[model samples]
Target chain A: MKTFLILGGGTGGTMVANKMSHHLDPAEWKIIVVDENENHYYQPGFLFIPFGIYSPADVVKPKRDFYPQNVEFVLSKIEMIEPDQNRVKLEKGKRTITYDTLVIATGSRIAPGETPGLLDNGWHKNVFDFYTIEGATALSRFLKFWKGGRLVLNVAEMPIKCPVAPLEFLFLADWFFHERGIRDDVEIIFATPLPGAFTKPRASSILGDMLEGKNIKIEADFNIMEVDHTQKAIRSYDEREIPFDLLVSIPTNMGSEVIERSGMGDELSFVPTDKHTLRSKKWENVWVIGDAGNTPTSKAGSVAHFMLDVIVENILRQMEGLEPLAKFDGHANCFIESGFDKGILIDFNYDVEPLPGKYPLPGFGPFSLLKESAANHWGKMTFRWVYWNMLLKGEEMPFESQMSMAGKWK
Target chain B: MTNPILENVEFDDDGFMIDPNAWTAEIGEAIAAREELPLTDRHWVVINFARQEFDANDEAPTLRRITKTTDVDTKELYKLFPGGPAKKAAMVAGLGKPTGCI
Candidate 1:
């Protein structure tokens, strides 16, 4: 029997297991999924938790809930990936599972300890991060009674998961404070390593203007040198100081520790993956997807959705002894929530910048791109249902695999 | 008065633009006061809304939608400036200083 071993039952691993289970003959092909944890988090919902927009229940689900019957769900930590032997060692079970084809979807996790003094004292106390379930839940409670002072949002380093999440938190905080009638008492500040609000030049320029409009102070090119929990301040490498009553930090993000232990990862533990094929650089039989693969795309859930078809197609090509197709074009789309029941949508790929246009059906789109409207807000809200049903089911979505350039104007 | 959103935009006494790409109420006011180029309501709004959203959120609004929701007619609202709420709003939003263009 041909063994198919899938690592990490996150978005990429789960989807592949579901899709391949139906295609491959069950008798001939045995599919096994291994992970340390049984709980699967709807990671995208983490963006809204701190804002009190989504509760923990909305994002949490059992990993076993999504695995198909044909696929073996083995809950175990990956000890190592012995690519030369075509096997993986599980720590708890102390068993070695051999595979003809191995897929790694062990996603990224937040690393706060990388920065000196970040976790020394103020962690989850005066300082909190919304990237994790625990952090968001704790921050929700902390924000509840925060009478007001300088609330500084710090983006420690780049290539973080859900790049716009920090911005969303800030906007929601504004809305939150405004709703609470304490907008007057609070001060908001954004500190980032990027020169502008975002990575893209145009988006950065626009977002920079927005920051100026809101009266939120911004400190750009501020590389964090250290955090003084006792003093309640952030010290930059350049000796610039920012004192804060509360710190909502976006700490460093790294791939699964297994990749590092296996000696197949870069400095940050992300698997060096071919941007188009989703294949591991060191081995052909091993494939990777989602935040685990070090691709130059936003580490968002939608990127995983966009990459699903490409990864599957490549795997199939390998089975048939053919060249993997160059289908994935780094398509990424996001819903940016502008306060006051309005939101903006942006869809683009590696080659194309976010342009003014409609979405889904191009001209027929009920949603407008780069335009803030109540309808966009509704669309953003409605996506939660679509994600739970359509996306997780391995069903084909209405949009194409690549980003559409239609209905966009220069 | 404690609201940083409503406080006087203290001009950079050192003439050092900490954020060269950053456009603020002071910059917007300077732009309006100079009237070197045509000023529109959309331009004002983009600067205005961006700053507001950024302050509330701690990041700026992406520029992907600057001209999408706004139009040229709203551009004419720049005439009501001088010492007006529209100008104040523009300044607060980081459009630029008023020119008494109206």
Candidate 2:
């Protein structure tokens, strides 16, 4: 029997195992998934936790609950991947597992320690992040009793998971403070390394307008050099300073350390993957999926789901002595929550930029594209149900893997 | 707004016909012309399939369903619609916006 081993039992790993289990016959194949943690987080829900929108229970579950019966679930730390030997070493027992094929789905994580003085005096007290459950929970508590002041939301660097999340947090914060009758007491500021509101130009302008309408200040092109906890300020490399009473930051996001120890990753520990096929550029039998792969796309759940479809198809073809098709188009769509029961949706791919229009249904859409609407806000909320049901189950969805331009305008 | 392809034919904000039933061969040609696509017999096959599917299901057909039931392969479907096959083909065929996680 041929053995297929997958690392990281997160969204990508779990979906790949479930899909492959259905296609590869049990008589001819054995599948295994390894991860260091038992809990599976609905990472997207992390954005709402700070505002008491979703509790910790709503966003987390056992990692084993999502796996198939046929797939072996191993809970252990991966020490290294010896690709040349077709084996992996476990950190716990120093045991080894051999495989005919390997899938690297270990996703990215926030590295708060990477920033100088970020974890200093005000760590988790006044300085916090909504990227993790603990950080989000702590932030929720901090916001409950504390009188509002300068609430600065900063992105330490780029390529963070769910790039739109920080924007969501900012919008939600505006709503949260207003609801508490303290909107006047709070001064909301968004400091980012990017020149504008977002990476894409068209969407950025619309979002920037929304920010202006909300009176949220945008500290554009601010590159942070260090967080001075003593001064309650963030100092940039260029000597620019932004003071804050409460700081909610998205620190540097990096890939799993095991990828680095294995010497199979880039400087940031993300595996270099073919943007089309999702196959590891260095190894024939190795594939990278989700945030773990160094693909030039948004590290969002939607991108992972699209990548899984391509990777699964390519793996099946490769097993039959056929070349993998370059089917993935970097297709990604995101619903940006703008608070006040409104949001915007943006869909695009490697070759296309998002444009204004109605989505799914041309002239009669309930959801608007690149413009704020109540329908999109519901779409964002409804996605949690879709994620747990259709997406994680490896079930087929009505949409195609690639992005479509039919309902959009130039 | 009125579509340039057909007189008195209304288009939505996205340029799709307000009434899909109002679509004709000429409308398809005009839509394709606006998209800068030259329609061929091969393009008709996919468009016709999309229309048939939409009539029965009240929704646009996914690319998987199109390639599985029709002679057109995935690569050829992409070639027919340069950016996105299901979305572009559905638009040209006067179908509603696609539903699902494309």
| Off by more than 4 A, model 1 | B1-102
Q: How much lDDT does candidate 1 score?
A: 0.77
DockQ score for candidate 2: 0.01
Candidate 2 local Cα displacement, residue A293, angstroms? 0.7
Could you tell me which residue pairs clash in candidate 2? A360-B97, A360-B98, A361-B97
Model 1, C-alpha of A304: deviation from truth (Å): 0.7
**Model 1 TM-score, 2 decimals:** 0.79
What is each candidate's DockQ, to 2 decimals? 0.02, 0.01
A264-364: candidate 1 lDDT, tens digit per residue: 88667889888889998879999988899888788888898899889988998999899898678989988877677877787877777777788887786
Worst ten-residue run, lDDT, model 2 chain A? Answer: A358-367
TM-score, cand. 2: 0.80
